[model samples]
Target: MPLVAPVTVHKISGETLTEVPDLLAVEEPLEIRLGFGPITDRQQRSVSVTMRTPGHDEELAIGFLFSESIVQKPTDIISCRHCVQDSQKEGNVLRVELHPDVVMDWSRLERNTFTSSSCGLCGKTTIDAVMALTPGPLSADFSIEPAVLHALPERVRQTQRAFAYTGGIHAAALFDVDGKLLLVREDIGRHNALDKLIGAAFWQNWLPLSQFGVFLSGRIGVELVQKSWRAGVPMLAAVGAPSSLAVQMAKEAQMTLAGFVRDNRFNLYSEPDRVIIGQVMAFKA
Candidate 1:
């Protein structure tokens, strides 16, 4: 069976019962373990246990490592493997092996009880926690026209295939200099979707996403800003509003943050200089 599927349920409300079809959200536990070289020098460390949809476990692991600063280059990772003792047991745990010299600082990650599809960022204690680990934003002189920002939400909406069917997944897409869609990834968790996109980019040998722009399907939160900065994305656009702290982080990173992008309109929260607003207006006029 595939990881996700749709089901119908009947509910009664005051003698009126109707069968409604709804998309089921898959929740599964995945434990990530890190192994560092040698049988005698082998040190196994448990990193994070994230509950995510089952597919793309390797991408999730690599994305986690990249976002956490555990590994810089792809060569830092020696190999990735998954093991399941029994199919009945939730045992698809992933183990990643990093180069012997790769240093890991586990202090940056917060211990969360359960990271669900919808509430991936809710477990965060404060913005300061994310800021401490988040690298400074891209210091590039890149700029995007407001017209390009206005056109993105519709383009992104059209690209989300899973969302078209389920309407329950989040998406993150990258666009090139000419505002062409480069890649997109959809997942139950917003952060995971972004991570999967970043992981895919890394797999394609496209690191430092400063030359491109990232468009998200939801609001820009602290976690979203942190992940974008870590990926070196110069500009981030969202279909919903951005948190105050997210704007602050964008300012610190010198990234252009725009939100509420819908219907040819958007709110530029920070670093307006990175947006060619006048050019868009001139073009419109």
Candidate 2:
């Protein structure tokens, strides 16, 4: 489906009002279903229904599963595709079939209720619940220069195709230590955009993304930190500020977190050693 839709709006500038054509980021519900269990006794269940921009649905589903700790590796998924039961639900439903040998964990599904595009951890019961699923502290073997971090926001902005048109979408981008953009994903939801980026990397067997950094188009939230940490991304920078809980979590995870990463300046919240200044160093990666 198209990521943006045409619309007409009345523009009011000063005393003049004029009708102009515009574009809006499309928001729609995507139901992600899981197919698991042994080959002889397969079972299916609806896990998540999220409102998101309609593009890269499969990546979003896989990324969501990975971020939730439901699926660990790319091989864990046997297949992922759109499977509509009713005609009314066409292009809105997706199914991910897991390998038969994978053990099922239904409790994880209970933690997530209905997810909105704006918030990812809406139904999460507590911080402890989220921490339980979080991975261990990242390795401090990687480092990047402040100049590389400053270049991320503008590079991400240039690649935001949907946002360029609608001016109403979030983005997540991956970059190497040298400031090279690897991948970018756009969505109506900030979390969803990160999920899609992670999902794409997961499909390419790029988990344990220790050598790369993830840059967000919005503020750093606890959930976003958790997701990036789960993906093994040691460094995260964003165009906006980091929440208190997000900074706390980043410290606990041993991850480098930078916020307000625009206009040649950024604030490091944790693992500041990874970002070197006034010195030249080599990264372990």
Candidate 3:
């Protein structure tokens, strides 16, 4: 399906109102189902239904599962494809078949009831519940220069095809230490965008993304930080501010967190050493 659709809107400026053609980002529901158990007795479960821009559906499903700790590695998945219902391809429904040997966790599927484009942890009972899933403090081995950090948002913006037309989509991108853009994903949801990026990296066996940093097109939420930390990303920077819990989570995980990363400046909330600055700066965290 197309990521954007055509629309007509009134252009109101001063006393003049003219109808002009415009584009809007497409938003649709994607149901992610999981197929697990032995070959003799297979079972399926509807895991998540999220509203997202219609593209890269498979990546989004895999990324969601991985970030939530449902599936560990790419090999754990036997196949991932859209489902066929009523003798027709159901574009909105996707199924991820897991390897038979992988033990299925029935409890994990309960927390994710329905995910929206704007929020990721809508169903979690507590912050500690999500915090327990972290793999521990990330490695402090990665580092990038301040100049390189300042240039990432624009670089991500340059490649955002959907955002260019609709101006309503969110994006997530991965970059190397020298400020090289490796991968980018766009969606109506900030969390889905990051999920797609992580899904792509996971397919390429790039977990434990210790040498790279993730950049977001929006605010850095605790969920986004958790997703990045799960992928082993050492640093995460966003164009907007980070919530208090997000900062605390990053500090606890020892991951670098930066916010307000635009117009040639950014604020480092934690693990400031990852961003190379000439002088020592004191931070309470």
Candidate 4:
């Protein structure tokens, strides 16, 4: 299905109302299921039911699994498929089968983990539990030029085909240390977009994202910070303000978090040692 849908909007200009055709980002519920055990004997469980953009459903499903630490690497998944044979369904259900012997905490997978565009830490019981999920303190010595950091939001925006068309979605893009756009995904929910990026990178065995960074189209939240940290990305930049939890988590993870990245300037929330402007200034993490 097409990622975007056409809709009618009423434009209001103080006293004038005009009907116009507009584009909207389509949001749908994607049921991510996990099937484990042998090829002949398997157990199925519904892990997450998330609201996401419809396209890239497989990527979304595997990405969600990876970011949530349900599966650590691409080889963990045996196969991924939508319930295409069920005529009663709209094909939103994605079942990911896992290789035998790959163990995960089944108890932690049962919460439904309902997340939204605005926040990703909805149902966690404690802050420490959330922090426990972050991969670890980063050890990458990579740095980005300030000009490279300043140009990221626009560069990421340039690849946001969905956001440019609909203006109603958030985006996440993964970039290498030298500021090359490696992968990009857009979704109504910010966390979902980042999940998709992380999942794709996992398939390529790109864990410990030591040489990479991420750019967000919306405000940085603790959840995004946590996901970026889990992926081992050294620098995280956004076009909006970050929350206190996000900054604090970034500091703990030793990840560079930058925000308000627009108009040729940006603010560094944590780990400023990774950004350079011709001179290598002394800084501590």
Best by lDDT: 2
lDDT, candidate 2, residue 59?
98
Candidates' C-alpha lDDT: 0.77, 0.88, 0.87, 0.81
Backbone clash total, candidate 4:
0
The residue-by-residue lDDT of candidate 1 on 1-285, one tens digit each, is 245687998988999999998766565777889998565688988787776766777887888778777778899888887866577644568889988887756554544211332554442344445555555446876787777888888888898776777777788899875678999877787787888788888877788887999999998877778788888888999999998777877887788898999988888888888786554443453
Clashes (backbone N, CA, C under 3 Å), per candidate, total 1, 0, 0, 0
Question: After best superposition, candidate 4 residue 251: deviation in angstroms?
Answer: 1.1
Q: Stretches of candidate 1 above 4 Å error?
A: 1-3, 11-16, 20-22, 37-39, 89-91, 108-137, 279-285
Q: Please report, as a residue range, the 10-residue window in candidate 2 with the lowest summed lDDT.
A: 113-122
Candidate 4 lDDT, 1-285, residue by residue in tens: 677999999999999999999999988888888899776778988888888888777887877787677887778989998875365556788889899878768766543233543545543342456557764588798888888877788888888888899989998898877789989999998888988888778877878788988999999977787678767888899999998878887888888999999999888888888887565568899
Q: Give the TM-score comparing model 4 with the true structure, all chains together.
A: 0.89
RMSD of each: 4.5, 4.8, 3.1, 3.6
Ranking 1 against 3 by lDDT, winner = 3
Off-target runs (Cα >4 Å) in candidate 4 are 85-88, 110-127, 278-285
Instruction: Give me the displacement of residue 78 in model 4, in angstroms.
Output: 0.3
What is the overall TM-score of model 1 with all chains considered together? 0.84
Off by over 4 Å in 3: 86-89, 111-127, 280-285
| Model 3 RMSD, rounded to 1 decimal | 3.1
C-alpha root-mean-square deviation, candidate 4: 3.6
Query: What is the C-alpha lDDT profile of model 2 across 96-116, one tens digit per residue?
Result: 999998887777756642243
lDDT of 3 at 43: 94
